[model samples]
Structures are given as structure tokens and as C-alpha cells.
Target: MTRTIRLRFFASVREAVGIAQEELALPDEVRTVGQVRSLLVARGGVWADALAEGRALRMAYNQQMTGADTPVGEGGEVAFFPPVTGG
Candidate 1:
């Protein structure tokens, strides 16, 4: 069976998309966090721009900050958020 990954969106992204999270089937070719974002982009326009490569994005895997190449095991949780600015 294919592995599934959970993606959580936060802050503006969540509000814009109107969803906090989603479960996605991991494609064999999408091996990195960046790739995963690109995959979501292909879903359509909103997804594409929201997950655009050049945008300011922060990522976590299993609740920890992770790089694009971080390996995601089965049923892992990946989160995306805009850069936090606070005092």
C-alpha cells in the first residue's frame, strides 16, 4: 500500500485555503518537502499559488523543523506555515 502523509496549514495559509489539514497519498516521485509542495500545486490555481516555490514558507515534519530532503515515513505529519513575526 502507498504511504499517506498529513499536511497541516497554519496562519494565513489555513485561513486562505479554509482548511487546517489534509491527508495525501505520497507519490513515488515526490521524495522531498519541496516536491510535496509542488505536488499540491498541481491540484489547481489556489493550491499552486499558495504553495509556490518562491514564497516564504516554513516547514516541519512530525512537528520538527525539517529541510526539503527530510525523509517522511508512513503516516507522518508535515506542516506548512508563513514566517512568524512577533515581539
Candidate 2:
């Protein structure tokens, strides 16, 4: 079954995606945060470049810091952003 999830982009990720937030319907195979990112990376272009593997990026699930292995349920929220630095 397909599930709907909210995506939030911040910092460079927001700039690359050109949007702050969006809702997407995910396929059954896309049940994890990593899979969700893979789906976006499959889009190619800036998406692949921005969220590419080996890049230092951070992910959060439902406002809590987590890894890509985290399960994403229906109506869940996932956020992507670069590592923050304090000046």
C-alpha cells in the first residue's frame, strides 16, 4: 500500500530542492527513511547531487534525530538538512 509522508528541506538541501516542504505518496517498498531518500535520488539531477551518497547530511524523523534505517509510517515527517556549524 502507498503511504503519504511529509518532507522538509533545510539549508542547502532546501536550496537544491527549491522547496521547503512537500507531501509525497510513497510506494510500499519505501518504508524507511533511506528508501525515501533513494526515491528522491532516483529523480536524478539536483536531487541526486544534493542527497547523493558520501555527502554529509542529517536526517530527522518526527522532530527527532535519527538514521535512515528508521521506519517511516503514514503521515510521518522526515526532514533533511546539512550539518549545522556554530560560528
Candidate 3:
């Protein structure tokens, strides 16, 4: 079965991906935010470096801050971005 979800990229992640948002059908193994990142990383090159595990990134589910383990359901929305700092 395939799970369809909306993905949103912000700031640097958006610049890297060259898109602000897109919809994708995820495979069965990808059920959480972390899994989605893993799948993107598997794309290698820019994707790998952008969403690399070592990168300091933040995530949200349906506009609510969430951890990597957060569950994602069909038609869900996920956003990725770098930590925000203001002085």
C-alpha cells in the first residue's frame, strides 16, 4: 500500500530542494518523519546532504512541531526546515 502525504520545505531546505511544496506517495517502510528523511537521503547528492542526519533540522506535522518519530497518516502534511535563531 502507498501512503500519500504533502511535503513542505522551508528556508535552506526549500532552496536546496528547489521547491516549496510537493505531494508524494511513500512506501510502506516510511511511516514517520525520520523514515521520510531516510527515504529522501537515499536519493543521494543534494538530497543526502540537505537532509543528512548530521544536519540540524526541524520538523512539523500538520503545522505542529513534532519529533522525527511522529507518525504520519494519509493526506498528512510534513515540513522540514533549519532551526530558527533571532537576536
Candidate 4:
């Protein structure tokens, strides 16, 4: 089944992805924050480069800082941002 989640991007991630937030419907295989990220990454191009695994990306689920493995479901929220930001 497919489900939807709110996606929030911050700092460099926002700059790179060129969006602050969005609502994305996910496939059944995408049940975790990591998988959500992977879904975006699969978009290729900037989505892949901006969210590349080689980068130090931080993830959150429902506003609580979490690892990519954190589970996500319909109407849940996920956030992505860099580890550090400039003043």
C-alpha cells in the first residue's frame, strides 16, 4: 500500500534540494526515514547528490532526532538537514 508523509528540509539540504517542505506519498517498501530518503534519492540528479549517503546528513522523525532506521507511516513527518550550519 502507499502512504504519505510530510518532508522538511533545512539549511544546506534545503538549498540543495531547492525546497523547504513537501508531502510525498511513499510505496510500501518505504517504511523508514532512510527509505524515504532513498525514495528521494532515486529521483536522481540533485536529489541524489544533495542527499547522497556520503554526506553527513541528519534525519528526524516527527520532530525527534532519529536515525535513518526510524520507522515512518502515513501522515508522519521526516526532516533532513546538515549536521552543522554557519552563523
Residues 1-87 of candidate 4: C-alpha lDDT, one tens digit per residue: 779899999988999989999999888888889888888999999999999888899999999999988999889999999897669
Which of the numbered candidates is closest to the native, going by highest lDDT?
2
User: On residues 1-87, what C-alpha lDDT tens digit does candidate 1 reach at each position?
Assistant: 588999999998888677999999997887778778778879877787787888898989999998888877788998989999999
Off by over 4 Å in 3: none
Residues 1-87 of candidate 3: C-alpha lDDT, one tens digit per residue: 888999999999999988899999999989999999899899998889899999999999999999999999999999999999999
lDDT at residue 67 of model 3 (Cα atoms): 95
Clashing pairs in 2: none
Which pairs clash in the backbone of model 3?
none
Model 4: CA > 4 A from native: 85-87
Give the clash count for each candidate. 0, 0, 0, 0
State every prediction's TM-score relative to the real structure. 0.91, 0.96, 0.96, 0.92
For model 2, what is the alpha-carbon lDDT of residue 87?
100
